[model samples]
Target chain A: DAGITQSPRHKVTETGTPVTLRCHQTENHRYMYWYRQDPGHGLRLIHYSYGVKDTDKGEVSDGYSVSRSKTEDFLLTLESATSSQTSVYFCATSITSYNEQFFGPGTRLTVL
Target chain B: AQTVTQSQPEMSVQEAETVTLSCTYDTSESDYYLFWYKQPPSRQMILVIRQEAYKQQNATENRFSVNFQKAAKSFSLKISDSQLGDAAMYFCAYVNFGNEKLTFGTGTRLTIIP
Candidate 1:
């Protein structure tokens, strides 16, 4: 059942606390992405990995960091959580030609 | 950087009626893709339909279809015989041939009236 699994489906943490959201995929697709969805902003890319050990920042990568050590794992870390960073996080994977991204059920994070 | 825009903030349609959601984008690249994604209350982003920029024919999936006006950079979603399940936030997205990141619009909240 690991098409794409995001850990702790929901999380509530205090400001300044370090929090990490994990995205695990069974698919061996080469591209993986992390995005945050908010009310009026829609979904904005945070970071993405083209392959293991290769990563790049998205438009909203200020407070977020991501790592892909293995083909199946992409981890997003909030070094210090902030209330403004609290939003629904989604992980997606895709093949080379088709841009259709399969998104995982989002992880709802709330910062206090 | 490409930008997607969904001008309508919210719209309503009576059950079984048709509704169209508008989306426009700005990009210099000619080869790219457009998409419509539905986010239900559960917050799961589901792909409604997609259109390739090079294609002249619109793409359809069941009750959902897209009207792609490439020259105009307008990609709109038309939901025929709208249902209650269609009530959700619809987002228009764009992805270039080389870039995997999907740029999304602000999204339109569609309400299905009884």
Candidate 2:
């Protein structure tokens, strides 16, 4: 749990629509990460935030964007949702970049 | 780039027996960290154990332990006296000492027979 929460445990939306997922943490960690879990792929990193207003792309950041306005909150957005983007999204945070991460319950998103 | 691989997609063990899950990774860096994470049906990811690349001794926590073969580039998890609650999808992850990203394996679903 690690004092982390993800909003909209489940979501469904049509293709071409925009979707945003929120991740909130109370630990005040300096590092936050967004990942998507698929059946065979396990989990893949979409984006990550080190500090407020500082972010970077991951292996699969083509259609995803992220923002961290505060130490406790990080948001992931999909400009235009697609079927390929449908998967369980997880938010993780850690005290340092190299430490073990704590994950949220996850948000299941579906794009039809 | 670092890549983690979990060869056993599924495994089963008797309630009171022991079982091992295999994991291997390809990393060019000499310093890194290896981790085992358990995701139950509830979808909660739990940290089972961790092994630092520089540590020669295997890490142990309760009934769970890791056999870290640095030279072989293999990390395996051993669960002793498995319980029914141990049924879950276990993932092997690796992160370099100074890297910010973690690479995960496909995962192995472990089942404990009652």
* Top candidate (lDDT): 2
DockQ numbers for every candidate?
Answer: 0.68, 0.86
**Span of ten consecutive residues with least summed lDDT in model 1 chain B:** B93-102
- Among these predicted structures, which one has the highest DockQ? 2
Docking class of 2: high
Instruction: Give the per-residue lDDT of model 1 (tens digit) for A1-112.
Output: 3398999799999999999999999989888999998888999999999999899999999999999999999999999999999899999888763567888998999999
RMSD of each: 1.4, 0.7
Q: How many Å off is the CA of B106 in candidate 1? A: 0.9
Worst 10 residues of 1 chain A by lDDT: A93-102
The worst-scoring run of ten residues by lDDT in candidate 2 chain A lies at: A92-101
Q: Could you tell me every candidate's TM-score relative to the true structure?
A: 0.96, 0.99
Candidate 1 per-residue lDDT, tens place, B7-84, comes to 999999999999999999999999999999998888888888889999999999999999999989999999999999
Which stretches in model 2 have alpha-carbon errors above 4 Å?
A: none
Number of clashing pairs per prediction, in order: 0, 0
- Pairs of colliding residues, candidate 2: none
Candidate 1 residues lying further than 4 Å off, grouped into runs, are none
